[model samples]
Target: MQNTPPRSRIEIDRLRKIFLAEGREVVAVDDASFRIDDGEFVALLGPSGCGKSTILNMVATLIAPNGGAIRVDDAPVVPGRPIAQVGYVFQKDTLFPWRTVEGNIGYALELAGVPTGERKTRVAEAIHQAGLDGFDRFYPASLSGGMRQRVSLMRTLIARPEILLMDEPFGALDTHTKLDMHSVLLSLWERERQTVLFVTHDLGEALTLADRIILMSARPGRVKADFKVDFPRPRDAVKLRETPQYAELFSKVWHSLGEEFAKGRSA
Candidate 1:
């Protein structure tokens, strides 16, 4: 069955979040609501400090919304620890330098008490999927920036989470490395079909990888625009930029995001 049932559903209704900074409550996200279908790649694009990461963290069950509600497959979010069916990929590689690539990828499985025989099988499959087959014994410090991040990704995948929450996972990479990671991410996502919520400030990054882009405004962030990317799959980040349709959508996102950037500056 090429079109299978959605593996999961995410619904956020009137989601709101606030934080205490300097003994004053500051609104981070206000009345935000969106739904992500099973197997969809949605990018959250907003200016820096616009609470994009805040929203991702809330949905990942790392933080609770002050008001409103979030449901993952109809289960209310009760943020205290990481959600069971969700995986997170952070802006930095969270690889344990003391652990080899194989050790890092299989760490979760080990903790879950997966038996040695089955755990080894899972780790081997994940390493191969991430193109780390021959480098399984390499330490993170010996790997390049991109390879380490790849290992980070494999570490998350080894657990087979139903949903993925990525918070600017490629933001710190150099341009060339960032571009390569985009392809790597897309390749894995295409095969895995996990519901994905990716938080990024880079519009080009969103366009290259997301099935849709949800734009957010400045402080007290809210959805400003929701743009569905009509580009077909197997999209090449470098080549997609040269197309006319890509040009049109790029202009629209830039114009809308420009307003929020200006507001952030003035405040």
Candidate 2:
């Protein structure tokens, strides 16, 4: 008997979506399909309002698509209940103002009815993993923007999901803070080995963090190009940006993206 090959961690097939906008029909994602292997860091890169978030949300099962199918770990998704299989980190910090860092991190476990002892152990590990050990008692307002985002990240990580869906989680931060968070996130990803589907508008961020970059079209987004990073793993953000290969790849991706951007403006 022959053994079957390993299945993909994520499989999206013929995904489609349409929206009714002010008496006009809008097709957001059309026949978009992609697959991700376990432990791969992949970025969905495109312009604003390009339906990347729409795709992410559909994959998360936060919204059901008009057509096609999504599967995670070879199992079909049950709509309205994607939480257990996937961890999502949105662009905005959705921390409860009333909850402290520890409270927020522990909330997921609480809702899931995890035992008190387990919650404590998981929250502590998440805080330490996110580098927020000393600020467990700090409220969101008391922390810096980066710190708050770190807390948000920990909240997601504590849930221990196999897949991570992030939508420009660092876009709101300043350049320096963004760079720091990138390093932190990369380290965490390397350690955790979760299959991450990251959405970002920043070209450098996509290149720096992703094992593969999926470039999408302007408005009704579709995959335009997918490039594998030839650079060695355990990448250094600052140093990688300085390399000749990095410059070449950046220019190629930018030119491919520029055409769609200009076309978007024209339409």
Candidate 3:
């Protein structure tokens, strides 16, 4: 029997978050709202401390909002109960040091009671897809930063989550490594087109990956601007920067984001 299609649409309405920091009531996000269509790749961009990660956490049902609401597939998000269809890739690779590459990637399948033979087969396929064909037995400590991140990504994707939330997953990699990871990610995303909500501070990375870019303001974050990226698919993350259209959009986004940066510094 064929599987049912995923209803991964995300809707955020007047979302609010407040934190108690150093005996002060700090407002992180204020009346922020946005939507991410099913199977669409959207990037959330903003200055530091602008609640980008906070919003992702709320959508994942990892945290409760101070006010307002977030819905996934028209269902209200309930804290403490993670959505089964959602998968998150945090900033750190958080791989198990004791597990080998294949062991790590197949951990979820193993947890789900998949038989040994089937688990191994699926793990092998994940390893190949991640370009880690020969490093199946290698541990995370023995791998480079990028290679370890690849393992982390495959581990998440192998679970077949319909919605993927990434929080600056490549922020630590060098330029060359980051670009290579972008290529790998685009290739994987094209295959399944899982609904993606990526949080990043890098303008270039946002431009290269997202179908739409959502910019948030400084602290007490709000939706500052929304941009549609019309570049054709199969984008070369490095080469796309050299195009005139890319330059123009970059300038436009920078102008809006730069203002927020200045505001953040002043406040």
Candidate with maximal TM-score: 3
**Clashing pairs for predicted structure model 2, backbone only:** none
* Per-residue accuracy of model 3 over 151-220 as CA lDDT, tens digit each: 9999999999999999999999999999999999999999999999999999999999999999999999
Model 1 clash pairs are none
Clashes of each: 0, 0, 0
**Superposed Cα deviation of residue 237, candidate 2 (Å):** 2.0
Better of 2 and 3 by TM-score: 3
TM-scores for candidates 1 onward, in order: 0.95, 0.94, 0.96
Against the true structure, candidate 3 has what lDDT? 0.95
Error of 1 at 106 (Å): 0.7
Better of 1 and 2 by lDDT: 1
- What lDDT does model 1 reach? 0.91
lDDT, candidate 2, at 142: 96
Per residue, candidate 1 scores C-alpha lDDT tens digits across 42-118 of 99999999899999999988888999999998988888866788999998998999999999999999999999999
Specify the poorest-scoring 10-residue window by lDDT in model 3: 3-12
In the range 162-212, model 2's lDDT, one tens digit per residue, is 899999999999999999899889888888889999999999999999989
Query: What is the lDDT of every predicted structure here?
Result: 0.91, 0.90, 0.95
Against the true structure, candidate 1 reaches a TM-score of: 0.95
Looking at model 3, the pairs that clash are: none
